[model samples]
Target chain A: MTVTSSVPGAVPPPSTEVGPRIEPRIALSIRDLTKRYGSVAAIDRLSLDIASGEFLSLLGPSGSGKSTILMAIAGFVDPDGGDILLDGQPVGGLPPEKRGFGVVFQGYALFPHMTVRGNIAYPLKLRGIRGAELDRRVERAIDLVHLQAFAARMPRQLSGGQQQRVALARALVFDPAVVLLDEPLSALDKKLRAELQFELKSLHQRLGTTFVNVTHDQEEAMTMSDRIVILRDGRVQQTGTPDALYNTPATRFVADFLGRANFLDGVAGSVSGGCLTIDIDGASVRHRLRDGEPRMGRTALLALRPERLSVLAPDAAVGDRNRVEGRVVTSAFVGSQHIHVVETPLGVLEAHTPAFGAGVLRKPGEAVALAWPWDGGVLVEDR
Target chain B: MAKRPLSGEPYVGFLLPATLLVCGLFLIPIGQLVALSFGGLEAPTLRWYEQVAATDSIHRILLTTFRIVGLTTVIAVVLGYAVAYAMAHMGERQRLALLLCVLVPFWLSVLVRALAWLILLRNNGIVNEALLGSGLIAAPLPLVRNELGVVIGMVHYLVPYAVFPIFATMRGLDGRLMMAARSVGASPFRTFTDVYLPLTLPALFGAGLLVFVFGLGFFVTPAILGGGRVVMLSEYVSISVLQTLRWGLAAALSVVLLVATLALIAIVSRVTGVRRMLGAS
Candidate 1:
């Protein structure tokens, strides 16, 4: 996406948001994007290609550079070294207004002075879209968010969810080629956040424009994104589909961040065929390695999901392979499942056992065997 | 207006002292002045009002006052907006320096400021001397003892009053709104005109009203700088009360000035809500 000099009058292609569903293409490309504040780097050498008509989320914790990347793409952050491309045209050094993007901010950023109808019509008005055409498009955008009833009301009079909808309508009313959302639902309460997430996802589906969202909420990213890019310390840790990242995380950070993970830090004992055995304290646990994975002999790490571990009776004969004995630290029924905290020789681990009809949960201090299938957890980078 | 006083009716007693103070110190004198403007308790007359409407000198004075105050308010608000914008966007040290520059002038006594302006703006003053020395002008120019001098002095004095309210509103504005405006395809100029300007308008209107109202009561700067030739309403009132001993005419003029100020507020409040205008004012 990088080019030598800035392109003067580089008009972005017209948005397909108003037309029939256009074919999905590469909508945005970030190449070696780097932004630093004195000594701290907010985004460091990060590159990502976002596809058109895809809900791509930048998922990371605070200070992990998720929001920074979104801001850079939105032309708010001037990168020290990098280029951003809109449909293969380098858009670096351009002012945000010339970049033609729709942004949904976390605080909603609704104009306190403008009513919902006026707020939605503002972008169109800027473009010289006037009269009945402007009104029609504004009403359509409002209808998209189901906000016709409150169209004339001011932004302050609306609730958080309604204000967020108005913000959404305002952003989409102009029909930009891409929309960048910065934790747009983070300010709302839990139930409202969930409801808005569904509404936002449905809206994205209906309008086939590219959506680049940034959020720290892992569940929000997983539930809404077509592709999730996990970031840590301003570096791309992993990027894949939701299930691909959840089922096969390349690093402990990814596994632990994307969902709950039980890390077994140990030393690699030996490799037999495709399986590598690791010594966890005194007991040994065998892990099946993936193709192209190098043979390991030093300290190794494995991330086992809690739901993958099955709870069994103390002296149950389920074969010792991939099995560990531990004393139950605590066991409780959470309506749908029985959660067991087991203190094993390696470390304390949790196993979410599916609850049967009135299943009796194991008591604390009682011995139990935790077993999993042969291909249970993935080998993650120890860090 | 609530079903019951949410704050409790007993707390209304806390306002008794302030209410008494306002009625005794402010309302009583204003009422007495209003009574004096009309002819006395028994023989009420509109003689002063008729004289005010008839006198050509009084009309000239009132017109001069309006023109000078109006021009000064416009200039002060414009300069105040520029200063507030700069202070809002500046770094800490620069902002502090700008703040001190504004505050230092505010702390100076009005008499001191007026006398100081007179000294600087007089015919053979530093400004005229510098211009003369630079060969920019053939004559020293009538820099003071004129209406322009009065406006210059008044703008310098009233700018600080205009700045603080606008500065407060500017500082409280969320940065994300600007970014949002830019993101929605508004050029920087368009953003300013469409969003930023409209949003700060309440404060701007409030500053204009403050500067205009404050300028109406301006006595020292105009009296000192105008050199008695450029007699504004306040100076006219002073001449009526002191030199001519025309108490009824002075009181009538005062009533007119108060009504004009109130009318300006009413006009602005009618357009923007009273609560909104007052909130920024």
Candidate 2:
């Protein structure tokens, strides 16, 4: 279910009526942000609006300016151009401390000298909250991260996951309006990272705070984010809901980045009724236009997910359209599914079959027929 | 029995060479001094110890030595922290220029630097000449041949030593931690105090102790700048040994000075790990 939440602390309830009209309920707006090191531009003109209380991830490979965007939001890296607005106020010139953001760095960056309790209590002390109230807030933050038992221990004495929790608790102690995570789970093992990913998502739901995370791991982004912004070469490739980007990727980059896909190069044919036929080499594969259809005679690239393609069983009739035959070159059993590599006339393709289900295993060099529904493919403009 | 070179011999072999060097160079001299302090010139008596401990001149010299050392250390550490902070955040060209500024004075001959200060601080020196030209002063000011002059020269020489260690530590510090602090709603000053300062305390204390100990044995700067007016322990000992040929008294005073400086270093060592403080740049 889609959920909308009132920000826990947008304004102090006194100045909400005097402001200008705002859209997207944007918790953080990075507008035309750019940073350069000498001659190399680290971040080119990038603009994105993050809805309040939503988990938005800036997903990119290394040097794609994902972490730079996160740091700019945290007010650590000053952009050469563009302005960052938090709740509709320009925050470009503001120092990091005045930004009031909570950041979980890649390595956690827990104060090594401080115990878990001391680390969490730091922001409270900075806010001038002390004594019993400070202790209660610290305790609440510690318990929120499920690190109460380890509060008295030094950060070095804790495990990687526990240290990450302490880092989270320390960041959240003062109840910051927004939290920025810079690959906070990249240091953990696979199992621990998976566990913390769930914990972080649940914590975001419980706290109702805007979270901007940066990661190169597409799985982490797809699993935890409300919206994922795919970045490449210091620019935004696409931004949308995970399903939207997955199913209707705006470009070939997004389609390939979000998940694995097979692309079919073709020349666009006529659009009769709602269906459009594309001339793929010598084979004519008909597809239904969902959103943006390619013009006639334009070279278009069709993106089809591997799982959507199915192998037809013997004595079974082929579908009305979008059917092809290929030879299964190799197949391997992978726990719950059998992964098959089919050598098609177009190219080699992959398909996953249920390992436990009633499906005849296709041995190597077996001639097979592959068919996909017309609605299961996306037509991306060749750029 | 022929030993199989001790199973843990490699580790010991690594530590042994350095340990032997330290013992031969440092421990032996201090041990000899301690032995001599308890011995006597005429006979094995406690008379020189009693005289050295009871005399007002030696006591005054000791007080002067500590005062100079303490003041130099405090000022150098504070100024060094500022220089180190500047170095840490400065752009490449600026950082190089500032580092050159800190090191050039340190590398210059101590006597030349002291003489240069004396020339600037004397009655008809450039400082008074400028002040007179600007009409800021009616007469030449008293600067050299006093405690102020000695303090100035000593602090100048010690500041570079202090800055290097603090700067080295600050450079290795993760800047992201400070960014994290600021993100948690701290002001720049508050973040510095709450996060950066505490992280760099070990280096600061270490630099202070190192500068202070070095300041105690200062011989050339005090002799040239003091002009016989401010008699630090080193100058006093020089006078006793060379001018008066009072060997017994000079040895006793030298022993006292050595012990006091070593004691101060030991006290500082207790505050933080000494090996680390000295080992770092």
lDDT of each: 0.86, 0.81
Task: Quote the positional error of residue B16 for candidate 2 in Å.
Answer: 6.4
Question: What DockQ class does candidate 1 belong to?
Answer: medium
Native-contact fraction for each model? 0.91, 0.89
Residue pairs with backbone overlap in model 1: none
- For candidate 2 chain B, the 10 contiguous residues with the lowest summed lDDT are B1-10
Off by over 4 Å in 2: A1-24, A34-43, A80-83, A269-288, A291-297, A309-334, A337-343, A358-374, B1-20, B40-45, B240-251, B273-281
TM-scores for candidates 1 onward, in order = 0.90, 0.86
Candidate 1 segments exceeding 4 Å error:
A1-25, A272-274, A293-296, A317-321, A330-335, A356-367, B1-20, B39-46, B279-281
lDDT of 2 by residue, B221-272 (tens): 9998899889888787788778987656777787877777778778877877
What is model 2's DockQ versus the real complex? 0.60
Lowest summed-lDDT stretch of 10 residues in model 1 chain B? B1-10
The alpha-carbon RMSD values of the candidates against the true structure, listed in the order shown, are 6.2, 6.4
**Candidate 1, residue A98: lDDT:** 86
Model 2 residue pairs with clashes: none
Q: Give the clash total for candidate 1.
A: 0
